[model samples]
Target chain A: MTGPHKERAVTHTRLDVLRLPLIGLLRRRWGRLALQIPLLAAAVLLVIDGFTGPQMAARNLATVAPWVHFRGFVVLVLLLAGNLFCMGCPFTLPRTLAKRLSIRGRRFPRRLRNKWVAIASLFLLFVTYEALDLWASPALTAWLIVAYFAASFVLEAVFTESAFCKYVCPLGTFNFVYSTISPTQIGIHDPEVCRACVGKECINGSYSPTPLVRLDDIPGGQCEVRHGPEGTPGCGTLLFAPQIESNLDCTMCLDCARACPHNNVGLFVRQPGRELLRPEAWPKRWDVSLLAISLAALGLVNAFGMVPPVYELQRALIKTLGIQSEWLMIGLIFGVGGLLLPFALALLAGALSRALARKKLSLRHTVAAFAPAFVPLGFGIWFAHYGFHFLIAPLTIIPVIQEFLGQPGDWAAFSSTADAVLIGLVQGAGLVLGFLWSLALANRTAARLYRRDAVPGLLPWALLLLALAFAAGYVFSLPMEMRGSLLMG
Target chain B: MSFFRLIAVGLLLLAAAGCRGQAITPTPAEKLSIEMAVEPDPARVGEAALIVTLTGANGQPVDGAKIGARGDMSHAGMAPVLAEAEGGQDGRYRIPFEWTMSGDWFVELTITLPDGSTMTQRFDVSVSGAGS
Candidate 1:
């Protein structure tokens, strides 16, 4: 008290969720399981209902939960919060057990460590989902869940770290990419604290000479004193707490927080899409940039598949080319429209951005820099499309669970016409706001790179983003065709 | 901790064993043609009726048939309008249906004859007219 430095109590900003009493539970080693267990139970119930309950998709818990509720909620939560789904993921429920069994397991192949594999997985997932019409079939939905668990287990069994989540899982990749726009992220309270510490327990993990006791080089820090249960696993994604710049690969697992002896790691809050403005945060790697571009394109293509007009388009394709199989038609649409066209657009946009620049910038680098700009519009499309469906029949899940439980409640009773206008308005606002956000991202990114020439540099992407936004509005204007409920075309 | 994970994985496999698709039972061959017409053509999104007519290969009307009609939207997860109808004169089954929300819909019919045999047919119905 007599010294020049006065006693300063440890405090957190208003938005730091880590400081919240209830959410602070996430700092515990068992926090993830608390959320995961219920989801695991729900998954089990769905699989059981999928196989044994009614085959009709609307009447089935397995189909409705995954295709409707899960998809809708995932996007909503990603936009509102961080990667909480990844935090509470049930697919990796056996991860700890798998890792225990494969203690000395081989590393993932050096060459296969990137987003490209995940990109391909996303394509495969979306294509199969649309081609097979997985939404309508409860049996298929159950099988999908089984396949997810099997894949997660097999990868965890054979390789070290989160190979499935980082490189293979489509949902994980989607969540990881969109979650960059989420409000919260794992961050250290002070860089000087982490720099001065030796254990580096956030990423390296905290272990003890014995179980059920606090153990560390640093005496009395966050994890041991506040979090308790000091010994915890390290970051599975290999993200160092201090070095982590964005939400790209962070699963929101909070392992870093639990393992941090300093309790320096905080789930801090920041503006959504603020990361998109930092082009330096995202490397100029081709896969990193192309993934964002293609995802935005994929959102448009996926939404297109659900509109009634698409059936007419499919019919025309069948007639013109004598395409016998609907699968073949769906495949062509996904391959060309979903995958190829996006790259083609990127080449055009990147080339134009390069050409228009006062300074000669590499076409690839320009493309990569502008790639983050796609996240908002792409995320918007997904959020709006998924959010609309979710809001339209948010409570329909109640009757579905009831029916599966042998109650057979009325589903139509939950339906409402009053909210349609409001939902539609919110959806429109989401789209427009997404468009404005993407433009701002492009402007900010280009402003940093080109400064005075930012407008000319970003003109191509702006036009492209505008067209994408316009296309999204047009498709949304068309009546949404409900898939899986009707007979196969 | 791994024990809990192991149990979760085991339950996953247990769930998988129950997921074989519904078996398709072969029905006896029958010569029946099916057709449907919507009252108030260009079906608007509101109260409606499906005039389903069943005719045999001999071109004679099939009567006393019980039709269980379920109208589903083309999209998944929306509630289906479930209604039942007994066949009337000329094998015409007047099935009462409400188009709650309109874009595209398909009505699946499970026709049970008086003889206690059931056959299924699906018809895609497009209601371009818009409403909640």
Candidate 2:
């Protein structure tokens, strides 16, 4: 890979880059919180619309929430820009305001750093969702919105800094993973410029209440990216720009680049798909384990809403357990999904690791490597579930809402089941496509690390397909009585 | 030989069994019917009490069924009060229609079946003003 580029590598020092005109604009001191205003407004509209606007029971419009459409578009924008979503995520608004704007709040303790717990809790969330019909119930859906706000506020209060968005948010994880396929990344143009810099203000909280940097002190205040201040912590997120293998941990706050004295960091487009191959640095076994389990749970939850039996089981379980629905549901979720599924996955991956590696690695390492393969399976399943909603639902949601609200409205309903079936087929096709794409990506990564072909490493793939096929059958067996009712009259 | 392989094998076997459990064949167009239930009130409709039952082919209760009907009392000299109820245990369904000074009142049931299928049925009955 090293060639003419290495020969032409200018290796510009900190003093030279600081004086450059172009580097100045790239590391400007303006806080990008301005970017989040539109996103916050959209989230507010989604909340209100879920309550006062009209019940999504209308079937069609209910499938595609205003938030999902907005989420996809925002992630697209983030993919184009550098960690723009983190810069302006509304989930972080409360924390930013509290620390910088308010003086009365207590500082969040560091010992309480419980990202793994948060990740596990999120995994348990999807499990509980599986055992319940929250997705089918408009009432529960409304409460989920309230829960997001509550969790964000409390986490911000209990933990100082952007703890919730950085370590806890599932949507943040989703954004980070999907953003891997994104063409843009945050990187440094000159490492020499970064090394000579003093007073790394970007991470040290030296800049204004925000990350904006002044032109006169551009180079010195810049973020050290990978490292923080000599003694103090640099890059609270621990992302080192000069040595960053991938854009995985980058929040794209631009604080590091903005705070640098030499204007060292630059958001560059060196290669189109290089980040996909880079191995993860922070090997948190528990984090990887939870994510693998979460990926499976996400597919099940997405498919669960479409199945009639799932709802029936949910109602029966609630009646039988005789517990408050939420607690019962949460317990069932953790018991089955969080605990059982991962145990099953770990066992499966361990066997494969032993089979292929010819040596006994700890269950942790086996599970982590096996976890990436499941990513494809998860993406495939998501495509199958959401793809159908994305296509056929727009046609029916309007009229359904109008009919329920007793108001006259303009909307087209599905003329036949064949139409619905066609949509399902399209969704199935998407799942297949995603499956293949992930398989290829996983193979490449596995081969690079494992040093042989990845084809033999496809045992997990076969298992995922079997699981997904079962899920599809369950969907088909749904009382399916509600199929036509989704259309507005 | 390993624990993980055992779980995978077990889940796969379970899934295979589920796949073999039951196969539901589609009923014929005529035999497949959706029924709606109505709460019966004898006092409101005069002595001519006839339960309005909507069916396709075989008597299958079609949930999520849609129906529309009106009483044709001009021909019978007395009208009957017809009403529909949410489907219940006995698989009976209902719709509301008023049988006025009746001769013969005709009822129509337009139903959208559970499987995204649609079927319509109609019933006609003779009515008299309390035999006066």
Candidate 3:
């Protein structure tokens, strides 16, 4: 109880991003829509190019933009900010429209409401991408975009309030998991304002009586009598600001900010991965734990597939197993890497953590509680992988754009030695930073759970993190196969 | 207005714009026309394929043609995989080559016609993984 270790209250400082004028602009009703329109237009153009333009993957917009630019920027933004891509997602626009048309609004099934569906979808996405060589087939990539739109439209048309984003959508899950370490998050400016408000407008949209209409007479309105119009709606995922803990389920749509009648919601800056340490704030669920660990494993798996060893391994498996279809072989690889291996590691770690903790916790609870700690390392691997592609061929987009515009241009002319070295260094630094952050989160979780005997609880998880870090480092060291890019073979 | 209603209107506009298809003009014909078919239908990585047939302007097999074939991943930075063949019987030149990896490979066939005019045509081939 002496020195700096003496028990004392720790004060947290937060910077309200809404205090800045630019955030005020983004919070407006049309703000997100304005940003989404251009993206939708780009999607439409990609589809057109995929269907009608040159079949060459390098020359097609569908193949280049999503695999190279979009994936790269998503990880970069998730690291720097919160889930900004989810905020401006164009796919949700159709869902919003379907809602307006009074499409049937049914609750998402309680049983299917966990992360299992998303996890399965994520695995399927990975397997399909590799099996079909989606990145090398512009037409298939284009159809994938169409499939996304159709799925969003159909899902939202039947269910109410962003079921596609919350319970489904692999990309959404990816963003949600990685954004645990994001520097920015939507938060309450003052908890007192939320306490006094009768209407939970942050989850349910704000409502007000129209000047001409009686409060009780407006049809389909929230008011007991009736209200003129349902004012601006709140969080699409039904997150209330005061109760919001982690970025786990949040899409960062900012509808919560728009629906706050008291202007109390604001985006705040805090220590990255702060939520992973706060187990009390989030519910410990088995599905989320599996999802987190699988994501971490899949991150390495995805990177591993591109290197030469995976090809050699696949060849060996083919010889040993006598499997004729490559899809089956790829599926076997995905099953081991994405599901079986990760689950085994999580089970072992959870067993150890339960054994060592001061308080008796269920194995599932212990695993779920500690799973968020793996996100930083998972995101680091992804960042390194996608960042390498982004850095080495940053200007690949220029020629792709030119080709899309019916102009002849050289997409292969963008690669160089110095750029590759610089990118490698940056990726290496990312891996190091990610590993350190994951270790810190693991330590924090251990200290919180085990108190005086934190070392025992921390040991197993630390080894897991170290292994993951080493795997990521080895992956980055390998010569990566840059699919769909002309600049990097 | 309900936020959904506003969004619905915006979606209508976007759908309209997205649905308006542009007329696709045909690309002008190239000076050299070469049709490449890999034997065994879908090519597999690490297996040899016989790429046969080279036709001239009149769509007939160009006899006595000197053909040089070079293959590489569509992406840059890798060393080129190459093969060459002169015209055999019926003006058909066969270049047997193997794909090192499973992905999109760009193959360039340079044909030196009987009249000494050289024409190069590039093609994209999808090579499947071994055991496919």
Candidate 4:
């Protein structure tokens, strides 16, 4: 097994984002707090608007900003950067203040540490959005924002670290899943420094009974050694820089960077989806596998909900089943599309792989190990769906701002046919790129697992990936409903 | 802290506070209520009749109002279908519009009252199969 130092030395080729002068500013003590203030203000406005503004979904800031603008931007950012939205999330700002007042520092429940709760939460979020027509209701969307704040505050006040972000938040789970492919990750600048250091400050924040003086107050702004009652802080997630693996649990809060006494932690740029290839970084677990598979299925379900065929299918099902409740119809569609379909596909792939490899691997273990291969295609579908909304009405934000100020402006001109075609091309490219990358990953996994004769093992997974990609490609080709903005009409 | 330092900190706090503007609540005089119905419920993907009954304060239907309506897909970037209707029997206004495609559509109505006050309301319309 490679030691932490060897891992660091090998991974040193990654560009250190903190080395940049601007990003380094975030390493300061108040850096995150400073960035959060404006976002918190925006959240406050959104909640207020939701309660007081016009009931129309498009005419209010409450609905447009979150559903239209925020969802679009989150996916785009995940594609390009690391989890920057989490870094700027305002939901946790209240928790920060509450912790300062009185913190119990309780640990999250041991039994509930897995991603099952989070996966369930994510599924519920998807179901509710469709069933309740959440995007069409400004007041409900506003309350969702309020509920997020309440949950974050209460959970963080009870627990010591970011329990909401790490264990419970559905949005965080979405970020965690998609961010597996993000190009940047927080890691150690030098593993040697961490190995020699006495205090592991990154995971544990610098603690003192009394308020510690800022290092800037001293002759030199930087401290050469750890001293005084104040101890350097550490990663809130308890991840040691040298041992930290993928972007799965990382919120990119940079607490580690600020807390490292030896200045070992730095945000590094690596190949996108590099973590998917590294099994050692994150051990294969049932929950994460289930999450990945569910995400893949939900990606299709999300896209299909917007297209014509699903609507037609729903109508046919309703007629045949004589289902009186529209909610039951929606429930059936989501259950089959999101849950049953993907689970069946994954089990089939695992069985095929086990049979082909001639190995004695447990079906569950094999499925868990190979589930990460589907992340790229899942992320591709999300990108295409959200990206379409973003590109088509990037300027929807303008009218929202105007309406908030009591001067509702005319809706901007609709995007040109050429623009729509260009977006479709980009979406197609995302699907193709994801397919190719997933194929490479599947092959690599096969080679690692089966050795010498990996091609036979790879074939089943390759076919599954191909089917997913083609389905996504077809969905992208269809005319989708752009539901969140008033600008369209 | 020095006077200048205090002022600087105060300015920073003020700037942060200014990020969110105050919420504006419409007064009773500014509030307009509207009720709408789309015929051929689950209006097929073609021409459908839209009936709107505009009301002012006290739940009274506002008669002699001029109405203009525009319909398009809920998502941005589609050509809009525009229609105009005059107030009819009992303050009911009727406008016939084509759905064009089967999906979620929003019909936005702008009503100009007899007093010349204009108010707007949006209705969500779901259209299914192609028209007969």
Candidate 5:
């Protein structure tokens, strides 16, 4: 704490900025449902409007809510706060219903209890969105929401654990990865308080009849005795308050805060993106590492799909390879450009890091340690693309909602800012900031790993990240083919 | 460099990208008025046509205007459909358009006057889910 004014830890102090008294409402048992109920109602309306109302994406609730507003807001909230999206997740309530009715189902298969499945699901989702043009189809978007709820119910009903949020659910997994960098997290007020407490109700729901504390649930969700009262629930994902290091798995459901008997767990604010720099922030697993890198790479592919160059690439590939199906070609791009190529780069970077540091650590550990450096850039690209839609068309949803409510909606109000220079510049700023954050994270991780050789070890990954940021910039600079009078070449 | 310095560099990059050049589209000096009639009275999904009555601000018919049309949904990312018009007598232009999906669409008319003067006008229309 003693340093020059410039070097003081004023900026780095892990003080609880968001104190317990500040978020008293959310710390209540049903606080989250107050938010979730409204969103669930909105989701239902979106589905109804998508299916039976106007089929136009812009005019329909399904297309506008999920694609534009939800996406933009999720990223914004994640970067600024934490996984607030999952706190009020509409699917969680329906999943809890399954938990209540199914009478404690069997445990999720041990072999299939990793991020690998979620990663695959996210990849498939990216491919489906582009190939099917899901963004433009309200019906399809509505169906997708319906499918998410159905999947949530079915998975929760069949599993003894909260398998859907932990091992499955691509959206949850995306939020989990990005949440690592968010500022606020569910944490204990004092370690001594947690150490002295016998009934760890944070992970174990506050059940009636002197509820039993399931200590086994504190680590890996093995303690599965779901006999809690109707109103009370704990960390459904089985994350202990005291042991929770990052926002990687916690859903930010505030259930932990509600369930903590000691009143110790609250939304404490910490440094954003600093969690990723922790030496043991993430487990040294290949699936976790690959998931982190893939999302970043896939976001680029997703953004590239909206630009004009992608169509030209598709046409060229079709002509040269005689590919008949458009979906198949796009799938190839996603699989190779999005998944495999980035993975290959990650492997090379891992190898070079080991070689430079003269360390013989396993490649899996090296890659896993460095994977977090990629998250910010991926989030940046996503923010840039989704934010563009949200910012450029801020008044778009008003007209759509009006039309949905049986009023004569003014489409003339559906005007864009038409300020390409300003919006593009904003997009560029977000992206570059993300890239810089990633670079800083990489350097810090390297320093932790290789000490004196940190500079050399981080070189390869730095280059790869720089290339990614450059690609993102180029795509942002290009005339993106969009609705209205945007990029109409 | 320190973390803060890197962020400062990123902001600088934004300032640089802000100065990036933009394409300037030239507009013809004419305040033309256009009255559009969708072929099927109320617009519906499927094969549709736009019959446009074009007139100059000088209160005369703009004859033999080369009319090109581009149509897109009100949202971003969908591929726009382009079409050319068939010129008729007395500044009337007929452009065939298809509402592939039932939704809100905006169609921009690229009007090339007989004297090679070019102008553009955009119209927003809602298509009912009635036709094929």
Candidate 6:
């Protein structure tokens, strides 16, 4: 809806003031280690809550989601501190626990590798959700949590590094996509400081406790562990800080930031939603594919709960697929919802890029640039679909509360019919708004690539795709709810 | 000068534009404006008809526009039905649904005016408690 700004005078004045000191402050790594632990604890709790709490509690959690409830505060924190989520990732606690068990020596098959197995597993999860009523099933929700822990623990045990978190984990992949819009990032103010340091300890994990080995009666020399392209020890997650031109791979893990001798790497605040505009920077197809999948999955999931046909399909899935177990449903739902849908979009984007470019952009690069655009769409559908349920579904509890205990209140008295109607209108409006936002973002990103007003060409097609998704959702959703209806009635 | 500043200015503009762009675009020519609402609350299932009204924004009463209603509880899906014709003015259409269960439901209405342009409206409804 808007164009890039070109106000020169104000921009020049601000740049002169910030350029040097901002660079200087970024190099200083004084209080980073002090702040990382607590942030990590919070992430762990969120993941834990995600499992123990309602699985599809999107609307309920919105009331308390750090981003939703405290957008201003969280934005301020992210702006000042670099990727605080990385600093306090509960995701790493299991890694530390694994290290203590000392079972990391065992490595998995090196050549027999295809990262898509993880993709397939997530895909299967979505399909199964449709098959078994995982949305309605709490135990299945618990199992998803268990699956995360077991998956992470086993992968780390075999991979000897944060391979699962870095490459294979779907939710991690999902986070990486959303985090692109995050104002805070891990980056450097000075390349020279990194060049002068004799040990280059940050990349090598300099201060890490070592095996007190005597090298010919001498003390400190070379590091025992090597990571990344240069065989640096510090970036165990395999991120090469210097080469990290984009935020895609940098887990915001402050190892390198803390390690650099010249106090560089300051996290600064920036504009929200700015990342969506800079389509040129997105480099990884895997990241894009993941994002696209995330968006499509949300749409599919939103539709998953809307159609009547799905109940019959689910019944048929149980009867015909012989996959009665929720675990299998989880696997199946994740497969379709998480993997296939996004992959299809990414593939389509690649095709569009190739057709539009009239040049062969490798499928990889096309997917990367195009895939991130879908994040808004995925997130939008989720907000719209869940917002409706959040507003309407809870009124049932009011009557239960009154009946179980002596109460004179009409259940509707507690929430009211007006409340339901208002919520529905709001939710429907929110969805349409989300759809427009996503469509706009998609058009903008695609325009930058296709180099014209892309919306006129793409809007209907994209809307058609969304409409198809909506219709398909409606078709699959109807019969399940209507099964009780008699033909005569 | 700095990349962040460029982003900042752009974001401020986007927020400003998002505020002003809320006007609903009227459906193109040869189309009808179909607005849908369900009575006694859409979320809680009681004996309430899925109410749909069809009218052309051009100040004309539009009728014979077949409206379909479906209940999708369990997020499963819906079985669509034509709104039974009752003695009424030409434009108004209502479909009664005795929803048996509760959860997410969607109702789709296809409105065909005399002008051959068909407007399809989809409304998603959630019902709670047993609908008689």
How well does model 4 score by local distance difference test? 0.74
lDDT of 1 by residue, A1-489 (tens): 122111111221336687899998877878888888878877887888888887777778888888888998899899898899999998887677685575637778988888889989998988788877788788888899889999999887788778898889999999988998988777767666666566777877775545543434343443342222346777888888776678998888888888887777888887676567766568788888888888988898898987767877877887799887756777788888877888888889888887787768888888888899889899989877887777767777887766665564575676433377887787798889989999988988788888888888889999999999999999887777664422254
Model 5: residue A249 alpha-carbon error in angstroms: 1.1
Evaluated on CA atoms against the true complex, candidate 2 attains a DockQ of: 0.02
Give model 2's docking category: incorrect
> How much lDDT does each candidate structure score?
0.78, 0.47, 0.74, 0.74, 0.76, 0.48
Instruction: List ranges where model 6 is wrong by over 4 Å.
Output: A1-87, A105-118, A124-147, A198-202, A210-236, A249-253, A273-280, A284-291, A312-342, A345-353, A356-365, A386-489, B1-44, B47-132
Best prediction by lDDT:
1
Candidate 3 CAPRI category: incorrect
User: What is the DockQ score of candidate 3, to 2 decimals?
Assistant: 0.11
Candidate 4 per-residue lDDT, tens place, B15-132, comes to 5534545544323225667788887776877677788887767777778877888775644333456678886667688888677656677788878777777777778786665633
Highest DockQ against the true fold, candidate: 1
- DockQ agreement of candidate 6 with the native complex: 0.03
User: How well does chain A score by TM in each candidate?
Assistant: 0.91, 0.70, 0.90, 0.91, 0.90, 0.62
Question: What TM-score does candidate 6 reach?
Answer: 0.54
lDDT of 6: 0.48
- Check candidate 3 and list the clashing pairs: A216-A225, A216-A226
- Give the alpha carbon lDDT tens digit for every residue of A1-489 in model 3: 122211111112357776788777877767677667777777877887788776766556777788878898999899888898888888887776676577857988989988889998898899888887787777888899999988888888888768889988999999999898888777876554555555667787764556222232122333332223556666778776776677888988888887766666777787777777778655688888888888988989988888767867877886899866767877788889878988899899878877776558788777877788788888888998888766655766676676566565454464222356688888888889888988998898888878987898988898988998998798778655534312122
Instruction: Report the poorest 10 consecutive residues by lDDT, candidate 1 chain A.
Output: A3-12
Sorting all predicted structures by TM-score, with the top scorer first, yields: 1, 4, 3, 5, 2, 6
Indicate whether candidate 1 or candidate 3 has the larger lDDT: 1
Ranking by lDDT: 1, 5, 4, 3, 6, 2
Q: After superposition, how far is residue A405 of candidate 5 from its true place, in Å?
A: 0.8
